[model samples]
Target: MRPNARFTDVQPIGLDAVAAAAGTDPDVLRLENLDTDVPPPPAAVAATTQALASGEGNSWLPLTGLPVLCEAVAGELRSRTGLDYDPSRQVVITSGGTSAVMPVLLATTEPGETVALTDPTYAGLLQRVRLSGARPHFLPLRVEGGHWRLDRDALTQVTTAAALLLMSPSMPSGVLLDRDDWAAVAETCARTGAYLIYDAAMERLVYDGHPRINPCQVEGLAERTITIGSVSKEYRMIGWRIGWIAGPVDLMDRIRMAVIYNTTVSSGFAQLGAAAALTDPSGSGVDEAAAEYQRRHDTVIDQLAGLPVVRAAGGWSCLVNATALGLTAPELSSRLLRYGRVAATPMTAWGGTIAPDYVRLVYSREPVERLSDLRYRFDTALTSG
Candidate 1:
């Protein structure tokens, strides 16, 4: 028997290749993974240890989530979005932010229905749409005045879509949609009856006074929006693999069924760690990490002057336009790895035909001091040709 035809056109080139290429090189600076070098908060670790020691986390938890974890997610959402959700019905934990996408798509959209996503989106999201058997349509974003702007005309096409997936502080570009754009998105989703899936994995990482806009705050959009967030980015707990999806109770009921069928439930111990992260009274760990990321963002922008790189307002990555280097993204990536000993993700991995001219550099993985060395190496590598 053969596999589903939906897997045919879904070839993904990811950062694993870059990591493998940079293997065992002491001088090689890894700028490929968006993972932070920061340690997980002490409290989070303690919480996980406690859960494991108590033996309570050994068995399966409620498919929705442990009550403490679910309550923590709802509380965090209320604090951020000024909206309250019932923990018992409105939130369900998943294996990770990435894992949450597939079930959401499966629960919301039927096979052959279209799911609209921004061009040059996260490659994993694109794969998820394909896995869900939904047609992937793109709403092209244009670089205008050194920022990524959503094309209004292209957005109109979203009206026919079964769902619209959006990532704030978008991957590769690091562009956060402004309030007006959020308003437009809300209007479109409300008018068209399309579900708005907001990927908020990096929501707390904004920089330079750029405010994070929650579409759920936009009046009619709350009921239709599903927010997927994780402790991976801000809490430095990527390996814990705990995330939550928050939305209307009815829709979340369907998502819970999907979760039950998929992984049964996320790690019970990991959920305890995530709960501690969200309820951290000091709030120093996440805040300090976000500040450090902002500093790295500024440092990279400053070091890469005169390059056609887009400025990152938030998130761990920004796109460098490699067209002037007279090489495709993959070719430039190879040269950088060979000569500069720097590993970066090529834009080819981001999917879509419009991304060939760029490479994604992640600032979060390296120390701020290492960024200067990365800059010098990149400069030497590009100019040597």
Candidate 2:
């Protein structure tokens, strides 16, 4: 191991293991990953197909990304944040949202520097911070009033951080950050001089009339924020592997260098599809998909109503309190997979104190029809195992 490496505390999220164990068992519901059965925009698919057939943009050139895709990303950011981004100067396409994250961390922080992240945040992100040689400082998300919330007191803790990774409709917990949360975030960042790396993978994937304040919308955060977005969630284009980073021109050069060196750009052909997905309003299907995901989220809550599952205000997964069952999350995960036919992932080192006490049930992957049997499965898993 390299002396500078910092991934010793990082544990696998258990999705791959659970998924591999699930194998060809069609009966096993695949809730272990962030996926959707919903199709991508037809225009995106068509564009990708055309790009592949034409063999256009098959070179290692254009290290940033396709012009159209970058412009589309800038436009999207502008519409949501009301902050204009110069496509050429302030944007760089990435392999995916996850890929974009590490580069931002690398660009913004030095080894042993602190990077604030939410406890119960994506394990991938926590591990990425570790991989980049940064200390992961978690802002605990307290379960309050049937929803997940960041601890206001904990926001003051991150004032020493070099970067703060934030996501609305935060993964696993599905907690949408409100106005107060954004305000607290602004205060923390302003005090710390930390870069706000906002993950927009599921920005628009909110539900039940909850509002998400774009980080850039917070006073002083527009220039302080670096937004990372991808087609994986909102546009339902996971396979395309295209993501973008948008920030101020001053900080963007280092981020762009990190982007180029990190993954050397997303697939050239896939960029065309992502551009199509971003530009084609009618076919993006974001709002419609959010509605369906909300239905699925509600269904999961209903199915596991009596269980200690936390309500997901928005996003893909629901956190089931494994501690209530007198078992660790990994133990519950195994039993659920074996007996319940559910492939929920155990929150091992995902982050925070409550992490290991819970397992995640990703609602986006399965349809409501398949999830109707969730209660029975949980019953069997709980009783038998």
Candidate 3:
């Protein structure tokens, strides 16, 4: 039997193709990216090595998760979010954050139901919602005071009997939802009985001295809001593919069932490594990476400020309005690779009705020293064109 082909319509990530076309080498800086340059913490490394040596991690963990890791995650949540979450009940460790969401969508929405998101949001969620046989409803975010804000009333009007998936410190723009915004969204979800799927993927990479807030902390939202996150960003363990879904036990039970077919279980040794990151995250690799990202963010911002075409905020990416150079985002992106030798992702692929003129330049992957090269080449391209 042929598998569903809905995925074919979903384009592969532009960054990978762009990087390939740009011909990345050790000497060239790669800024169009996510994840970190640093490795996972030593504790995780040591524990994984120990687990492998003892042959302890060879067995598959339970569908729900390894009990110890689940408990550790629970403790981490209480410490970080100040919300008392029962690990044994509320946590289901999936392969990663992406795995966590699929089951949540299946459990919460029926075919043809809507999954709403802010405009120009994360691309992955858009593809996931479509894959689940749901329509995507977009609420275009208006920029005010150099930050993106949701129109609550507009969102309520467009979406009913749907699930809203949102990322805090959102991708591309990196706008962290304020307390008031969170309250408004929570209230909307409650009134409408819409399941809230909070993707805390980019929340930890926050800048401008903002505190991270989980949507589950909203009053009466613990039962309704499902949070999907990973050890990728903060733990710098993107390769480990460890992530989770935390919410109501009953809801998580359904997610656990859907997880049975998708790789069945994550790597046992990797889970051990992930547990160490969760339990002893402070001295872990996150601090150094966070500092490096902060510096890179600053460097990218400074470099883009010199460019007539690029503007950015929050995350380690700059969205350049490239239409003035007489090219669509993809065309400009192609040109930047062939001519300027800079790789960037066009914003059009991210879904919604974002301007086709804009391209997202990921600054995180490039080292601080190499940033000047990308800037010089990129700016010169704009000038010469």
Candidate 4:
């Protein structure tokens, strides 16, 4: 039997391929992943262990999520965005941020509808839209004076689109959409009667003292926006596989149904751990982690100075213009893996026709001390070429 036609041409460039090219584990100073070197918070670990021992997490939970976890997520959302949501109705705990996307897409849009996305977006999102039998329309971002800005005019042109998937403090480019950007998107969505799917996987990692902004907080957009968040990046709990989706109650009901028909439910113990992580009295180590990432960001940008690299305003990764080094992103990535033993992801995998000349380097994987080594590797790779 043949697989689905949507997946026929979807060959993702994953970290394993990069690791193979480097002939080493992807974890070894390999900057291909956003994984941090830090361990999980003590509270999260203890909560999960306690849950497993008490047998509270051994069985399936409600498809919407456990009550405690839902409340924890709702409360966190209220604290962050000044938006109140009913724990029982507006929030659904998901397996991960990636897992949350498909259900939302399936629940909101019909087959063959156009789903808009920023060019150079997360590749996984592009595939998910296709898997849902929806078409994708990319709105290319413009780089001006080192900042990546949204093309509002282009977005407004797509008046017939059904939904828009946005990652603020977006991946790879790491450009955080400012308030005006959010307003433009909200206006466009409102005008077109389109939904806004906000992927906030890296929401809390903003650097250079910039405050985090949520599009849902904008006037009139709350009811039309579905916000997806996870503890993976902020709390350093990537392995937990816990995340959440929050939206208007009526739409959330459909999403809950989708979750039931999809994964059924997320891991109970992982939800417990995630709840503890979100509600931890000690602030969950998020601030310290954000500070650490900011340091890594500054260090990496400084080390890669003189290269055609745009400084990342937020998020864990930044884009390097590989053309300056006389190589395409994939070519530069392969050469870097072979000579420098550094595994950087080519932008071809991240999607968009505009990304061919760029490579994405994740600084979150290596510690501050190892940054010097990363710098040296870059020097050798570029000079020797």
Question: Each candidate's lDDT (Cα)?
Answer: 0.84, 0.88, 0.73, 0.84
Tens digits of per-residue lDDT, candidate 4, 263-323, equal 8888999999999998999988887888888898888888887878888888888888898
Question: Comparing candidate 2 with candidate 4, which one achieves the higher lDDT?
Answer: 2
Cα lDDT tens digits, model 2, 1-385, are 4554464776776789888898978899889988789888999999999999999768786898988889999899888998888999999999988899988888899999999989898988889998888898888988887778889898986658898998888887888888878888889988989889999889888888878568788887887899989999989999999889888788889989988887886798999988988899684899999999999999999998878889987888889999998998999999998899999898887887878789999978799999999999999999993
User: What are the per-residue Cα lDDT tens digits for candidate 3 across 1-385?
Assistant: 6877656546565767767765745544565677556677888888889989998868776866788788878887776678887888788788888777778888889988988887777677777888888878886766665456666666658547678888876777565687777887877787788888988766666676777777777786667888887887777788888888787777777877777666588778888888998888465856567667777777766776644333333455656666656678887776776567676777776767763557776766677887766667776656664
The residue ranges of model 1 lying beyond 4 angstroms of the native Cα positions read 1-3
The TM-score between candidate 2 and the true structure equals 0.97
TM-score of 3: 0.91
Which regions in candidate 4 have their CA more than 4 angstroms from the true location? 1-3, 23-28
> Using Cα atoms with residue i matched to residue i, what is each candidate's TM-score against the true structure?
0.96, 0.97, 0.91, 0.95
Ranking the candidates on TM-score from highest down gives: 2, 1, 4, 3
Candidate 1: residue 247 lDDT (0-100) = 91
Count of steric clashes across candidates, in order: 0, 0, 1, 0
Better of 1 and 3 by TM-score: 1
- Predicted candidate 1: what Cα RMSD to the true structure? 1.5
Residue 156 miss distance in model 2 (angstroms): 1.8
lDDT comparing candidate 1 with the true structure: 0.84
Q: lDDT at 45 for candidate 2?
A: 91
Better of 1 and 2 by TM-score: 2
